[model samples]
Target chain A: MKLVISIAGDNLQSPFDARFGRAAAFCLVDSDTGAWTAHANPALEAAGGAGVQAAQFVAGLGARAVVSGAYGPKAYASLSAAGIAMHLAPGNAPRTAADVLAQFQAGALNQAQAATQDGRH
Target chain B: MRIVVASGKGGTGKTTVATSLALVGGESVRCLDCDVEAPNAALFLHPVLDRRQEVGIPLPRVDTALCTHCGKCAEVCQYHAIAVLGQTTLVFPELCHGCGSCTRLCPEAAITEHLHVTGVLEGGLTADGLEFARGLLQVGEPMAVPVIRELKRWPPLRRPALEIWDAPPGASCPVVETLRGADFALLVTEPTPFGLHDLKQVVGIARALEIPAGVVVNRDGIGDQGVDAYCADQGLPILLRIPMERRIAEGLARGRSLLETAPDYRPAFQALLAAIQDRVNTEYAP
Candidate 1:
């Protein structure tokens, strides 16, 4: 299973990006091998519908679950359709991607059943 | 020629100018208040709005019984208006652009379309004999272009010698729709910083659409010459200037035209019209 985490930098130590659709980058981790890679979010500057596009990109990457600080209604809907569980990163924010991944692996993070906030109109 | 009276900033007197022009031009003019979201030129023009036509957009509807849930419709929608989850498909009409791509691309032939009323187009005749029309967008309707389009076409005849379009304030999609096929953009502005900033934005839109524009400086004595200097630098003529006077505003508050407030400006407006005709003749002649 692969896990995708919205992030701010290319490394595991980078802060988790709270914004799902317009996040600067996404950190994808191989659950079995503990190997990971970062991809710059192509939907960061999208004119509109960034949330749905990002959700599609994450699903295309074969991510079984996603970790992020927040999820928008559209992103939540799309990810749910793709059968990917969404996990919120623990702490106020700026929590490292590795910390979020560890908490998820440790079963500390909770799965989100709905969107945390509204998105752009 | 169709002349659009636009103000990049709000409260710069687009309606005042447009309504006055319509009143002055009388039988030869067709006045279209295209600011559908807040159609207020009627307040001053007092057109007897008797004709009403509801405007709507085509929205997609899925026939679940025929749908195979292949997710092809979801994949084809650029706005994510449709989503397929498991064996169920969801359609979000608010996000749909009504391109009919989902209906045409669906291999299962499950998608259909239905009309959704978004606004109404109203037509009437002013007491002064000019044809008047306006669009009223339904509250909370995100789209205004359809209403404006319907209003523009509701007149039944484009044979009027001139069409004065009272456009909405701003350089957004609604403004673009209003300016689309206009022969000239009679831009109204106040000589203020905010007015100057927004004027530049609208100017860019007009230039992009290849429409000629002129400036009308309202509330002239209240602010600096930023707008004047900008216009001078850009070679745009300042056609008319209404002084910042309380009496003129008081007359407007009472729903009176500029000609009603002070008849002295009647000749000025006429001269302004003549100048526009001369410019259009020499520069815009086909």
Candidate 2:
């Protein structure tokens, strides 16, 4: 399974970004092979509907799951419809994407069951 | 001539000036309270509303039986108002702007337009023989332009008479929409730094839209002369300066027009109207 994690920088050592749509970059990791690739988030500077756009971007990349601080209603709806799982990262603290992926592998993170009201438009 | 009474900041006496002008202008004046988010000109004008019409926007309703689940509507929606999930498609009405693009672009012809009520348009006559109209937006509605458009398109609005529009605050889309096609714009501002900052934005919008505009400094004596200096530098006419008075505030609180309570202030409003007409005539001369 491939997992996409929102990040502030374009490297595995970059801190995990809490925001899903406005994140500067996304790190796509292959869970079985432990290989990862970084892509710039095109929705970072969108005027509106950034969350849904980001969800579409990851879904197009065939990501099975997404890790972020929260998911808006539109983003949640898109991801849920595409059968992609959502997991909540730890707070806004400076944790690397690699650390988050490891936490997910160790079952230390919580899976999001529904969309959060944190940043719904 | 159409004169829009607008302000960059709220609570700057826009309705006070607008209603006062409508009252002083009398039988030939028609007032439209275009601030649909919070219509308050009627509170002061006290117009007897005898007509009410529902204002609606065309929202898309998907016919699930005919939908191909191709997600074309979701792809075309800029607001993310629609999400096509497998065999199910969901519509978020509040997020929809009723642009009808999705309905038109649907390849399977499964989308149909449905009327969604956004607000109500009301028309009536004030006790003093002035024509009055206002748009009241429904609670929690994000868009007010549809209601304002309906109010502007009302038959009485196009009649041969003096038209005064009390626009909403801020230089956003709604303000631009209200100021469009007006012969003159009366920018109301208080004499303060924040007031001056926002006034500059509204003025910029008016100048960009190529509408001739003047300034009305409400609460004139309370703050410094920054607004005055800015207007002077811009060469914009200072139409009127209403002095800051506790009596004016008290009267407004009781929903009374300054023209009715003070009576002496009626001339100022009338002069303001005349100045607007004169400027429009001179600047727009053939």
Candidate 3:
């Protein structure tokens, strides 16, 4: 199963975007088989129609699960509806990526939830 | 006179220096904290807001009830902010750059553009006669330009007012938006290697923007001599050197504005103000 993960604060996942300027993205390897690709959550710069294109870009990448720090309500819903799994990474970077993929493979990952869990945003 | 106090790197004491300058400049000045995200200047100045304005960005609102999924809106969007897949259309608010290309390109007129509030611009007066202003980006919103733009458009400070802009770090949109059209940019920096690295980044940005820039070395005793040397080599004047004093850190830790404690530092800020005024006058002399 393909996966999508949000690396920075679970805002959104962008595998192809080089946004945020200095964030890093890498493919997580499990059993020496690369199982996931993660990238930084650069601030999004699209408005209106461009927004849809961004969502489409992520959806088409065959991401089944997204392990991110956080996700907005709209994005959570759209990705969830598309059957993309969402995992909340407690921390960020290479460690977060490893932990998330491990949790998913163990079938212990919870269903993706909206950002309002923190009563913020 | 508009004075933008900025640093290319975050946590380099930009807010600290800006707040001190405002306090020293007396009440005839306005201080605008353009660092929308993580604005800490208010923690020191702590002004009561007297005015507030909603800052928003235009996003396309697609009428789902309209027939057809032509995907024309997505095709014209240069930033890829919108997309239509099969019978469904998806919108990523954070990715939207607020350009109206989609609504304009829609042949069926199904897409109507609307404004979405991303942040708030606030203005008020501190008890010490200093005017305070800042923009608060709604958590999760990515765009800082609209808020910064609105903050700048706020009524020009009653003239002759020394405007201190506490700008966001880095050379990105937020930083550019804050520095745009400023008369002078005061680059706040530390004496560390990281500070020197980011300072060069900001200096390049300032040169690109064609703005006259200077440096204010915070924590002068620590770090190395690279900052001073760089300024001399680049012909960028060193505007102020804030010696790394324990009392300064202590006062900040206790939430007391630096000027409130070390009143002697007031003269330094005043002198720096005078020097800046003189330099600007000389440079812009007719």
Candidate 4:
């Protein structure tokens, strides 16, 4: 299974970003192989529907699960519809993508039931 | 001639300037209050706004029975107002820009459009015989450009001596809609840092849109001389200056226009109109 974590920098050690759609970069890790790759988020430049665009991009990447601080309604709808699960990053700011991914692997992270916040236009 | 009284910063007396200019510009003048979000020119002008109409956008509604889960509707929506997920398609009316791209491109023809009312356009004649119109956007509505667009188009003007467009506060989409195709932009601003900062932004917008703009410095004595210096540097002529006064604010609280608070300034506003007309003719005669 592949898991994606929203991050600020290119590496797994990059700081975790609270923003799902406007995150600077997304770090994807293959749980079985432990191989990781970072994909820069293109939705940051989207004038509107940034959440929808980001969700579509992540679904296209074939990630089974996504880790982020929060998800907007639109993003949550798209991801859940594509059968991709969402896990909320534990704790507050200053956390790293790798830190959150470790918690995910340890079964310590909480899975989201629905959208965490209001959607922006 | 159309003169849009705009301000990058709010509460800089845009409505004050626009209303007064309309009063002085004679019965041949019309006032279009384009500040849809918080339109208040009616409070001062006391226009008998008997003529009213609903303003709305064409929002798409998807019929799930016919929807093939093709996701084409989601892909075509630029505003992300629609989403096709698995067997379901959702429509976010607030996010919809009413561009009709999704409705037109739905391959199965499952999408239909309906008018979603967002605002109201009110107009009639002011007590002073000036044709007055304003757009009032519904509370919490994100889009104001559509209402502003309708205000300019409805009950069309008859090439009045001047059309005073009272624009909203900011250099955003609605402001652009208000300034579009105007003969002049009468930019109102206070003499403060915030005023100067936003003024610079709107000036760029005006110049980019190729609209000839001038400044009306309301509350002229309150802030530093930055506005004067910047206007001079930009070669944007200072057409009028309304000094900071307590009586003006007092009068405004009672919903009095600048011309009503101090009718002596009537000549000043008249001169302002003449100056704008002369500049428009001399500089942009077609």
Candidate 5:
């Protein structure tokens, strides 16, 4: 399964970014092989609807799950409709993207059923 | 002649100057408050609304039966208002600008348009024989351009009347829509840095639209002369300078026309109109 994590830098060791749509970069990890690739988030500077576009980008990448601090309403709707699971990362303290993936592997994260914030409509 | 009163920064007395202009112009002028998001000119004009009409935008409605999940609508929507997920298509009406691009480009011809109420346009007259109109944008609606467009289209009194538009702040699309085709744009600004910054932006808009514009510096004595210097350098005329006065603020707070409360300010507004007319005539001469 492929998992995508929003991160602040262009590598797996980078700190996990809480924002899903406006994240600086996305780390795509193959769970079975542990192979990871970093891609810049094109929707980061979108004038509007960044969340929806980011969700679409992730879904297009065939990501099975996304790890982030929170998901906006539009992102949540798009991701949920694409059958992609959303997991919440530790927000109070800084965590690396790799740390988030490790926590998810250890079953330390919670799956989000609804959006955490109201996105601009 | 159509003269639009606009400000780069919010709360810089656009309404105060606009209402005072309309008041001083008397029955010869018609006022349209295009600040649809928060129409406050009515508070001072107190026009008795005799006509009201709901304004709406045409949003796309997808016909699922004919839609092949081709994602054409979603692909054509620049605002991400439509999202096509597998066999399902989701439409966010609030984000839609009603451009009809999606409906026109849909391959399956499965998209149709339906009117979504964005606001209301009202027309009436004040007790003093001032014809007034304003647009009230629906709360939570992101779009204001359509409402302003409708307000502009609202017919004024049959006789020739000087149309004065109380424009919304900023150089956004709404302001552009308000200033479009206007004969003159009266930019209202404060003498502060923020005010000067926004003034330059709105002035750029007016210049881009090729509309002659002048400035009205409200609360002139409170801040530095940076705005005046900037306007002078740009060769933009400073039509009026309304000094900072607590009494003017108090009277406005009470929803009283500055022309009525201060009386002395009436001549200033009148001269402001004359200056605007002079600039418009020289620039637009045949």
Candidate 6:
């Protein structure tokens, strides 16, 4: 099944967008195989408003669960309203994609109840 | 005529140049600060806004009572905005773009849209008679484009007055929204490698949008000379250069404009304004 996963963590806020605001990291994962693709929040992308498209892209990639460091109430509410499963993965290290998936498969990692604070943690 | 001062990189003096030019242009011009997320232009212009209005976005609201959890809304949502876990229906408003696709696609018609305030737009006049508009996005609010869009919903200019815009940094949505109607864009930059890199990124966007643009190098003495070389290679004119000055930094820290503190630089701004006017006149002449 297709999914749109909101993501957060250290790697998401890397110095990539120093000139612009940092984008939340999101992942699109497959339900059957647990494969995933990563994306920067399109909303925080150049010229803004890329969030919708990014979310759609994640959904297109067949993400079932949105794994992120945190989700503010508004973001949480909006994503929840949209039918996406919101999961908070707070303080997760920037590991290889496999490790993240491993955590997901083992049920050791679940969506955080909330998105982390907006700036540098 | 409208000129948008923008930089793909932040802290490159976009606001400094914009406010200085507005001050030098004197009473006939207006300024709009479209950097809704972090609007610092007001610090320099010191505009006294007489009016303020809330900016809003539409989000889909589901009527749980009227509907069976059919999963149709979930199916229609490209962003996974709606999920039916058993009988419970969940909505995540931040991820929702208010596209109204789910409401229309829902077979049960259980979905409706509601307006959610994202920010506020403020308008007023600076001491020198320049009309000013600014967008202040609500803190922690993820949506900033709506507020920036609201700031641009002004009555069309009835006369030939310069509308200089202070655009937000980054080549993102807010910058695009602010630059929508600009006759020309004054791209500000520093001389750093990172600055040159982002300048290229934004330059591509400007080219794609078909907007005629020029460059203004701030802190002219710092960084490498690549930014200048790149501008020359692109055949884009370097309109003006502001030499690195300690006083300018001090003035900015104290909430004052560079032009206000250094009246001697008025002539430089005037010359810059004249060059821009020439560009606009040549391009838009009847």
- The DockQ leader among the candidates is 5
- Residue-level lDDT tens digits of model 5 in B1-286: 9999999899999999999989878687789999999899999999999889998899999998999988878788888888886567888787788899999999999999998999999988899888999999999888899999988987776553688899998889999999998999899999999999999999999999999889999998998989989998999988998999999889998989788679988787788878877887888688
Candidate 2: stretches off by over 4 Å: B85-88, B157-160
Better of 3 and 4 by TM-score: 4
Q: If both were scored by TM-score, which would come out higher, candidate 4 or candidate 5? A: 5
Interface RMSD of each: 2.3, 2.3, 4.6, 1.8, 1.3, 7.1
Across B1-286, the per-residue lDDT of candidate 6 in tens digits comes to 8899999999999999988888887677778888888898888887887788887878888898877988788677765555555466766665566778888988888888888888888888877777788889999788778888888886433342788889999998888888887889999999889889989888887887788899999988988899999999999899988888899888888988988778898998899989988987887788
Clashing pairs in model 5, backbone N/Cα/C closer than 3 A: none
Mark the regions of model 4 whose C-alpha exceeds 4 Å error after superposition. A10-15, A28-37, A91-99, B157-159, B284-286
Displacement of residue A73 (Cα, Å) in model 2 is 1.9
RMSD of 6: 8.4
- After superposition, the stretches of candidate 6 with alpha carbons farther than 4 Å from their true spots are A1-121, B154-160
lDDT (tens digit, per residue) of candidate 4 on B1-286: 8999998999999999998998898888789989999898889999898899999899998887898979898887877778765566777787898999998999999989999999999988877788888999999888899999888989754557778999999888999999999989889998899999999989988998998999999998998999999999989999999998999999998998888899999999999999999988987666
Q: Once model 3 is optimally superposed onto the true structure by TM-score, how far is the C-alpha of residue B103 displaced, in angstroms?
A: 1.8
B90-137, model 2: which lDDT tens digit per residue?
787767888988999999999999889999999898788789999999
lDDT of 3 by residue, B122-237 (tens): 88888886889899999988778998998889884465368899999897878988888888888999999999999999888788888788899989989899998999999999
Ten-residue region with minimum lDDT total, candidate 5 chain B: B153-162
Judged by whole-model lDDT over C-alpha atoms, candidate 2 comes out at: 0.88
lDDT of 1 by residue, B152-257 (tens): 7675444799889999998999999999999889999999999999999999999999988899999998999899899999999999999988988999889887
Worst-scoring 10-residue span by lDDT in model 4 chain B:
B155-164
Tens digits of per-residue lDDT for model 6, A1-121: 4433444533322322211123465555565666545666655542332333344444445455665555544444444445567554444345544454555567776664653444221
Q: Which has the greatest lDDT? A: 5
What's model 1's TM-score? 0.88
- TM match of model 4 to true structure: 0.89
Residue lDDT tens for model 5, A9-107: 989899999999899989999977889999999888877778878888888788999999999998888888888999998678988998998998988
